[model samples]
Structure formats: C-alpha cells, structure tokens
Target: MKEPYEKPLIKKVQVGLSNKFGSVYGRHLRPEIDGVPISDLVSRFGSPLFVFSERRLREKYRQIYQMFSTRYPNVQFSWSYKTNYLDAICAILHQEGETAEVVSEFEYEKARRLGVPGSEIIFNGPYKPLSALKTAVQEGAIINIDHFDEIYDLEEIAEELGQPIKVGIRLNMDTGISPQWTRFGFNLESGQALDAAKRLVSGGKLILNGLHCHLGTFLLEPRAYAKAIEKMVDFAYELEDNFDLKIEYLDIGGGFPSRNRLKGIYLSPEVAVPPLEDFAEAICDTLLSKLKPNDFPKLILETGRAIVDEAGFLITTVHASKRLPDGTRSYVVDAGVNILFTAFWYNFKIELEEDISGPAEPCVIYGPLCMNIDVVAENVQLPPLPRGTRLIFSPVGAYNVTQWMQFIRYRPAVVLVGEDGQVDVIREAENLNDVVDRERLPERLILKKS
Candidate 1:
C-alpha cells in the first residue's frame, strides 16, 4: 500500500517589470526560453553580457550572400575582421565559406589560426606593419596597398626577398558620400592613384592585382556605390591598357549599413536602406558594361555590419531606479557606453520584458560607470522600470564588441544562442585576475603586502 503523501505547499512570486515605452515581455527579456536568465547569467558569469543569436547570424549571412549570388554570376563576401574580431564570430563566418578582410597582421594571424587560406584572405588598410606585409606576401594573400609608402614598403620587402609580390591599390573616388575626401586611399582626381599604379607597373618587384575603395560607413545611398563602381572600373581599364595586366578581382570595400537605427533618421529598416539586390545590380551592370566579358573581375564585398548587426543582442539587468529631484526618473543598468559605443551615435530602443499597463514617461538611462559622459540614453520616453528588471537592446551585433572599452570595469561574457534556442557561452566574463594577469608587482609593493 502506498502511504498518503503530505499536501505540497505552493509559493507564489510576484515580479513587476516595465520599460519607458510601456513595452514589456511576458516576464523578462530572456534571450531564450528554458535558457539562462540575465539575473542567473550575472550570478554565474556577471553583468553587461553580450548575447549573439546564431540563428540570426546564419540567416543574415544567407540573406546577404543569396541577395548577391542570385543576381550576380560571381559574388563573394569577405568578412571584415576589424568590425568584430571575436574568435567565435570569425570562426562562424569562416565556416560559412566566407573569406576574410584583415587590416593588420594580428587579424591576419587570427584568420590563419581559424584555418582560412591566405589566398582567400584580402589584406587591406593604410597602415600595415612590416612583419604583417611580409607574412601576407609570403602567404600569397591579396594585399590591397593604401598609399605610396605601402607600395614602396612592398617593393622593398619584395626586393629583399628577391621576388615579385602581387598587390592591389586602393582608389579614392568622388563617390559623393558624406565626410568626403577623408584621408585613406589614393584620390582619383589627384592623379596619385594613377601615379601609384604606374610606379607599381614600372617597379619589377610588385604585381598589380586589382583596385579597391570604400566610400564610407553607414552609407544609405546606393547610387554612391554605383558611381564609385563606375570610377573603379574605369581605373581598372586604365591599368590593363597602360600595364597590359588583367585585373583579377575588384574589391569594393565594405560599408553596408546594418539593421541598427541611426539618430535623426525616421526611416525604418525596410525602406531606409537600399536592398542588397540594388547594390548587386548597380555593380554588376556597371562592371559588365565597362569591362569585356572575358575581363570580368571577381566581385568581392567586405561587408561587416550588414552581415552581423542583427545577429547580436545586448541584455542587461536594471540595477536601480530613482526619481530625480526635478521629477525625472533615472534607471541604472549594468551596461554603459563602454560596451555600447554605438549608442553614442544611435538611439538604442530598450524594450522591457514584462507586460505592464502604464503611461510612458521620459527617463534617463545611466550605466554603472561614474563618468558623466557614460550615459546610454537620455530624455527618452520609456515605460517605468523598477529594480531587477531586465532590458533588451537589439541590433547591437556589429561595432559594439569590437569598439567597446574596458573603462572603470571589466567586460562581460558573450553568449551565442543556437538555432534551437539553446544558449552557449562563447566568451566568458572577465574576472579580476584577467585584468591583472600581465601585471607585475614591484618588490617594495609585494613586501608591503606580505
């Protein structure tokens, strides 16, 4: 006979959550169902956690790749490493058969460690150390030289090695983009680009591969790229005619806009930016019309933000909330400008995770940092949020992690949410020991401590 079981006591927990905009999730801004909560993650790993959605990442990658591949015969995406160089992110892109565009030797080494072939990698940027240039050349990477100094350096290195090194020149054209004439590549009107090409062809140590140029970042205008392509094709034609060398690839450097919303921009994601199809059509039409059918160079795009921006979400817990003397409410979170550097340029829409019926009110969001410039959001209308509430900041997957500063605090862990909604910690939160691992103690200080 089974013994009678005692009545089990039930406990009810009440938790109120809210955002300034009166938007909330059913409970909290949990990244995954049946997965770890922000609070629990902080308990185990700490606060200011960055969570990447693997599903979103793969989806975005496929969308961008398909957008170009479906329209253009030959299209390749070289992931921009400087955007976000997290090993896990790089590995994911590499696993997807995406090539890499590295600006420095360190990033080149990183790509090599990920098993990416140097031939598939495109070495770009204005300033590459001698060691980096030597390594890239020895590895047979497509070196996109930025200026005449770089050209001279490559020539010197090649002469020293007693071999011809293949390289490309970055052309700066009047793409009609904002902040125009920024110091970077060779300007088209200045004749410097032509001079550089001439010097490369005349020099026996260098092999001119192709032309490269990036107008600018966050470029909403597709026509700019179209015009830029027109100029690049003309330059390529000139190089072929002048040097009798066929350009193998035309690397249109990456600056494609991500899903993030910019300040003072009212357009939504659907209409604000031109679709990848538009860019592909422009580039393909321009190149196909300009170059002979047999001379069509392999089109390469070094996209960073558009490929990975939507893939990441930064989740933080509300530490405290208080009403100011001026009757304004201020909410403090575990994250700040350190990790969300893009917040300086964007108005990050923070969403609440719980449902609540309340009028929206203007509130200031502050990070845990003590600096006055550490404000994340100010004078933004938000739903009332109390302490212990979790908030979700979407579309932070691009420049945040790469540009984040470890000021007044250690950085947080980065987790990847799998397709099945399972969470895996891709990067562990930094500990005190991590900050001091390389630090050496003086004998006097050590003696005092002892």
Candidate 2:
C-alpha cells in the first residue's frame, strides 16, 4: 500500500551565489512554506491551492504600521477590502487592529459580518447606491464622497435623517505620475476639488472632516507620495483658514506596490520598486513639515496590495508540456487566468517543487483555460518540468482572490499556513454543486431524461 502520509523531500534547485572567499556557486531550494512541505499540503488540501503565511501577514502589517507611527503621531491604516477580502485574510488584519476600507456594498457587508463595527469602516468607491449610503450613514461609517452626485445624494439622506452628516471628499491630482487617475474624484489642479468642497460645506447638511486621494496602484516612485501629501496638506490648511473646517484626517490612499515585476518593465523589480521605508520617508517628511506640530491631522493609509501581496502563494501542478513552432517550450498548468488573474499584469517568480536538473531554457507558461488569451508568462526561464511537477508562485496575495472568476472549472481551495506550521483550509475547492448552485432553470427548459 502507498504510504498514508508523504514524507518531506529535500529538493535541489540551481541558484547563483558568491562565497565568502569571493567565488562560489550552488543550488537553493525553497522546499517548504513556513515548514509545511508543498507535497504534503497538496496531498491534504487538493491542488491549485492558495497559501497565506500568518507570520508574514503579521510582519507586513507591523512593518508598515510601525514605519508610519514611529515617524508621525496618530497614524491609522484601513485594510482595503477589494484587494483580498478572504475572511481569513481580513480576520488576521483585523486581529492586527486594522479597520476595514471597502469599495462596494458586498465588501462593506463582508467587513461588518467579520465583526468590524460600522464606525471603524471607511466607505469609498464611485458606485455606492442610495440604499448603501443610507446603511453606511446610519452605521456611522466614514463615507468618502466620490462624485458631485454623491454630495446631493448625501444631502438628501441628511435631511431624511434630520441630522447633518460628517463626510470626506475624494480628490484626484497629478502627483508626477503618468496618465493621471482623473476619472475617480474631483481634480485638484483644475480647482474642481475646491469647488466641490465649497459646495459640500456650504450645503450645511454635510460636514467635511477629512480629505482623501488615491494615486494610481503599483506606484514605483516614492516621490509621488511626497507630492500628494504636500498638495493635500496645503489644501487642508486652506480649508481650515477659509471655511474654519477642522480636518480630522488626511487619507493618502494606498497605491504602495509589491515586489512583483510588471510586464514590459526594463528594470528589475528591485531596481523599479522602492522599499517600504522609502515610501514612509517620502510621506512622513512631507506631513511632518506641512502640518502643525501640535495639531496635525490623523494620517490614514488605505493600503491594500502592499500588506498582503508578498504573503500569498499559489501552488499548481504541471499537467502537459509542448514546444511552440518557434521552438520555445510551453507548459500548461492546472491554474489559469480564471484563478490567477494577476498573471495578466505580473511576471510572477515561479519555483519548482521537485528536482529538475537541466540547463534553463526560455519558455511560455499557459493556464488550463481553452482561450488563447490565457497565457500566464510570455517568456520565462525554467528547466523541463514533467507531469505532476509542482510550481509555486509567490507574492500573489493581493487581488487574485477578489478578482478571480469561476469560469470553465471550479475555483481552487485557499489555505492559511499558521505561524506554528498548522495548515487550515480557509476556502474549499469548488464542486459541481458549487458551480451550478446559483443557477436557475425554467420549467419549460428543463429537459426530460431519455
């Protein structure tokens, strides 16, 4: 009989390195995740699994929180729910003391169901319906107005409730980034932001207590934060001086990038993506200089990707291999864009779980999807991988789960690797019932058995 449990295997992988004497070369294998063997995890949880390290999750939150708090007084972080709202992920962050920052009604409800109070939630996004607004308002969530219509909508709500509502207005500005995110909020450079603020405060039914702006995502340049903070702080002071508004918080919304390299970037991720420390310095120095030393507004970071991306992993199995007409190697894996959606934007670092000895060759990695557009990586370096071989993808903790779709196949199970090496399944692998459960059929359309 086959063994009931698979023993941990020590595998070797080629890696480049230098010795202390100045010349050395060898192989390095990341054989396990938090000491849990990849094969063991697969055997227990099924294939195409997502693994999050609890230790890493806590480390990232503590790192970003410490970096900001030690530099500035009264720093708050709201976990961006749109990134990876898996209950396990959110619960861990909530345990670390992060409030929820949701963009939609579903996400808001998810946060509340997770035991986060309404007052602690930061409600944002452009598509909040009237019903959601009423719920958010009644629950005391920090509502950030996205468009001019939202102002009118909230004014009506305040009148209905017979109370003036406290709110924040989302602003968009050019922080020296390309194709400026002009679509989301009022533009600061065009004076539209100022006009909107004026209209809100003058309405008498709404109180503007906070300022918010989210520069685009995957931000590589740390200076963009400096520019955003400088502009927001100046505006906060102007509002205080002209309208006597007391700005309680300045939400420099999150766009902090992860280590994942984007396609077509000439520079490597290390050269392209600045460290978190650099971002903290850029943001804090500006806030420390621009605001009053004694009464600085609370600094709120609505960060998402940065906190969770590096803590996630996706383990997949290679089922088939082929050579393109052009002679490039191609391999198809069990997980596809339907599951690993970020594969479209990032060239993830892939590691082999089994020992494969050969010279590395340029290759293409494709998903199991039938669509031609389901390519994962254009051209990557990997040794020949046989059937049943496992590949581990790192830093996929951000938006994959939230954005992933249940297309041609059932979505995979997601598990959390605890600090003590205990593996717990957070999401189960989908079954046929899971796929058809929400679907309905008409009586006339139901076909009778032959």
lDDT of 1 by residue, 1-450 (tens): 674443443323223445443333332334442354555655665567788877778878888888777766778889999988988898888888799999888889988997898888998887899888888888889988888889889988999899998888888878777787458888888898888888888887899878888888888887888888888888887888888988888888888887666777655566667777777677777777777766667889999998898788777878988777667778999999998999888766566655545545667999999998888887665566756777788788888988998788889899887777677788788878988889999877876444
Local accuracy by lDDT, each model = 0.79, 0.89
CA RMSD of all predictions: 7.7, 5.6
Pairs of residues at least 3 apart in sequence or in different chains that clash in candidate 2? none
Q: Per-residue lDDT for 267-347 in model 2, tens only?
A: 657777899999999999988888776977889998999999999999988988877766777999998999899998998
The superposed Cα distance between candidate 1 and the true structure at residue 367, in angstroms, equals: 0.5
TM-score of each: 0.89, 0.93
Clashing pairs in 1: 19-383, 20-382, 20-383, 21-382, 21-383, 25-353, 25-354
Error of 2 at 260 (Å): 0.9
In Å, residue 232's CA in model 2 sits off its true spot by 0.6
Q: Which residue runs of candidate 2 sit more than 4 Å off their true CA positions?
A: 1-28
